[model samples]
Target: MDIFIKIIYAAISILVATLYGLILIGIVHKIYARVHRRIGPPVWQPILDIIQTHGRKVATSHGIMFFLGPVFRMAGGMGTYLFMPVIFGSVVFSNYSMAGDLLLVMYFIFFGQLGMALGAGEGGHPYSPLGIARGLSQMSTFELPFSLAVISIAIQYQTLNITTIVAAQQGGMLNWTLFTNPLAVIAAMISLLGMNMHSPFSLVLAPQEIPIGPPIEMNGSFLGILQTNRALFASAKLVLFMNLFFGGATNLPIMMLKTFSIYMFSVFIGAAFPRFRPEQSFRFFLRIPTLIGILSVIVIAYL
Candidate 1:
């Protein structure tokens, strides 16, 4: 009965996270409309887009693996949300806590990326080559400072459990992780900008450079699923980042607002800047964020 309860809880949590992500896509679409000075599609636009694309023709791949890729991506993302702490005193799947550290979570993120890369390769499209290369390169470049920033947070709190870290920030916003380690937050903020694939860091999918990057050849139903999942993943990332620094609030709307604020900032920056060359992105990631991460460690160590 205990195991069965856990299963049901996991399912409910995954559903909540996925739907929350979908709603966020709607929210972002509205934000984009405002930013671009045109009325964008409805908040439900992404969901509609995916539904319309369902069952349309697609480029066939090495059969089962190609079919499995998107499914796995969605599953992995859902799995990720399962482990993440949602509110004070609650995480859906407690067992995942045993292995859910900054390092483990990072690895899960990479695992999803690798799965997408392999699936793209199996599709045998010319653009897939470029997309995978660009994706991998971008991932490699930003990972250094991102890792360091996570390490700094772990050190400060003296624990790797994300739930504990967020719970510790109970008093007020100033006591939040962001104020406690500005440099680390800066590094994390920059890394998130890249990880979110926003403007200056959008070398991987620069329309002029690679045109949608890893998902270039994907189309129809498969592409639709991938697109929906992309938005879902993006929202989930924001939640994870917020939980890291802001602490989980009992109020859902407040949490949503905070997460969307960070997301909108990214989108605004994206609209304002041009894409970076891969090399330029790598350099920026390394030099500035690494400096911040290092400084954060120093501050945390003695202060």
Candidate 2:
């Protein structure tokens, strides 16, 4: 019965994540339609894209590891969602939260990225050369500030558990860490934007320049897993961000609303700006928000 219950919850979590992906794709479709002055695919277009791609043939290389890459990447992401707390509710894997710290979570995020990078590089496509370069460059730019911001919060709460962090925000919006340290929030937001591969910071693909980045060489069922992985990881990252600062929702609608709101806000910002040059992105991360993150930590420590 315990195993059955966990399975049921896991399935529900997946369903919720799928619906969230559909919503994000739908919004992108609407935004593109408005921008190009033409009707776009239906809201369910991404769903169709996923299904159609799942059965297509893929070039086999790197033997088993090539296929294992997406599997491991997606599995890691899915396991992360199980361990990560949503709202005040305990997650199935929450019991192990004490075994690791926020730093562990941060490392796991890198693991997910590394998996994609390895798979992309191993695919033997010269086209992905620029993609790999951009990905590494982008990672260097974003990781510092992101790490500092997490450290700041971890220090403030004196614990690395996601649940405890959310609990700290219980008095209402003002008690939320965002209000306590707006600069940290800003820095973290900048980092999150970059991490999610969104614009301004989204130099990895640079639609006008680099194309789809590391995933450029991929197709078929492998691409399907990649798509699902991206969508699920994106949703999980958004939720993690919210819980980190704004606090997770006690209600489902509000939680979804928060997730969608963040995603849309990201899209709006992405649409508003052109891509940054590699050097420009590096400087922005190192000189600007990086300093802000440091200062926020200092300030929050005093308070």
Show where candidate 2 strays beyond 4 Å.
1-4, 90-101, 206-211
Clashing pairs in 1: none
Report the Cα RMSD per candidate. Answer: 2.4, 2.4
Please provide TM-scores, in order, for all candidate models, with all chains considered together: 0.90, 0.90
Cα lDDT, model 1, residue 260: 77
- Estimate the overall C-alpha local distance difference test score of candidate 2: 0.75
Quantify all predictions' global Cα lDDT against the true fold.
0.75, 0.75
User: Please, what are the lDDT tens digits per residue for candidate 1 over residues 1-303?
Assistant: 977887787677656656777777677667767878988888887678778888586666667777777776766565556566665555453425444765667776676777788777777778887888878878877877888888888889998887788778878889888888778888888888898887898778664454666676577877777876676677667777887877665566776778878787787888778878888998888898889888888878878
Name the runs in model 1 displaced over 4 angstroms: 57-59, 91-99, 206-210
Write model 2 residue lDDT over 1-303, tens digit each, in one string: 976886776677766776686668677767867766878778887778789998787666666656676876787566556556654565642324445546666766777667777777777777666687877777877988988888788888888888788888887789988887688888888887787766687767654464777777677988888778777777777777878888777767777888788777777777778878777888888988899899888977886
